[model samples]
Target: MNSLSRMLEVLNLFKPEQPVIDIEVICSQLGYTSASAYRYVKELSNAGLLVRLPRGYALGPRIIELDRHMTQFDPLLAASRDIVGDLIAQTHLELLISELYDSTVINILQRSGADEQALNFGRGRPMDLFRSATAKVILAYLLPRQLKRLFDNAAPGDLERIGLTWKDFSKAMLRIRKDGYCISEGELDPGKSGIAAPIFDEKGRILGSITLAGNSERFNAFNREFLSTLMIDAARKITSRIAG
Candidate 1:
């Protein structure tokens, strides 16, 4: 791979589950020679994208700087912060704002309900797009060709887990588009359910998804119509704010 591509590959190796990675691990994971792996890590560390730790390397302060900039200025998150809090207060459910980045669904921010501590959704963590209402709602808005490409690239087990074969998956995407929102049960987290709506830009391009999640029992107790309405409304408001 090219130097830039190799650097990005090194950065991508750090996951929420494994925040620190050394040259040895990178060499093993990427099947790179020791010298090549060290060169990639050294470049990233020099650029402030990765930091040297006693044990290995972690994401550097540059990431935090970028995150602070996004949290402060990202139209979607800034516009929807109060609205997400309002949704949590009104529905007594945890809320999250997620963005689709390079086909991965990333949790950007979260608002807690009464059981704040119990709501363990990790902020900035990448989630499988096929596994949650939050991500699926965004997927519902992708162009047909893009959707097909993603589906074609997916593993059979992932397709089956989402309960869709190729033919069925297309039809289900259509239904999600028609419904304007998605309801997922025990998909992302067992025993937890969520409802999500897509946020769009002025051009009707999908921006991301806003979701309200809670215990399945709590979701069942609340009015489904009300929850869906709230989720969609929040999404629209965020879209509008960004448009202006």
Candidate 2:
């Protein structure tokens, strides 16, 4: 990797579980020489992206500042904020807005509801490409070449979760696109279900998805058809806001 790429890779090494990483671990994990690792650490620390800690290095205050800027200024988040709030108020279900970042899907915003079941997805967490309603909805709108690339790179069991073959997977995505929404049960989180619809940009290119999730039993008891319609309408409103 180039120097810039290697530096960014260092930041990606930090996670919720491994929040602090020492230079030794960075050197081992990234296959960098001790001197190179120290140089990278010094550069990152100077930029305020990493803070030295007794244990190691933790994400710095600049990350939080950047997050604040995104919350205030990201177009998708700004467009969906009020609409998502209204949907949560009306359906009393957990609402999530997820965005497609290259081949990965990540939840950008979420509002919890009455059901206390912990979700596997949250802000900044990656979603399963085949299992999540949020991810599936966005996948449905991906270009054919893009879809094929993901299909080719899919993990061993990933495609099997959705279909036995690529043709089957393509047909499944076609159905979701035709229907304008996707409903998934126990796919990401056991005992929870979600319905999602894709949001689009001014040119009608897919941007992301809005999902409403709740207990499986509650979803079964509720009017799924009506819920799907509501979700689609909300998605359209957000798309319009983006266009405007």
lDDT (C-alpha, whole model) for all candidates: 0.84, 0.88
Per-residue lDDT tens digits of candidate 2, residues 1-244? 7998888889989877899999888988999998988998889999899999999999888989999999899999999888887888887889899888877888899889778865778788986677778899999899999889888888868887677678998999999999999999888888999999999999999899999998998777878789989999999999999999
lDDT of 1 by residue, 167-212 (tens): 8998888888888899999876778888999998889898889988
In model 2, where is the ten-residue run with the lowest total lDDT?
A: 156-165
Model 2 error, position 36 (Å) = 2.9
Clashing pairs in 2: none
Q: For model 2, what is the alpha-carbon lDDT of residue 181?
A: 98
Task: State in Å the error of residue 204, model 1.
Answer: 2.3
Best by TM-score: 2
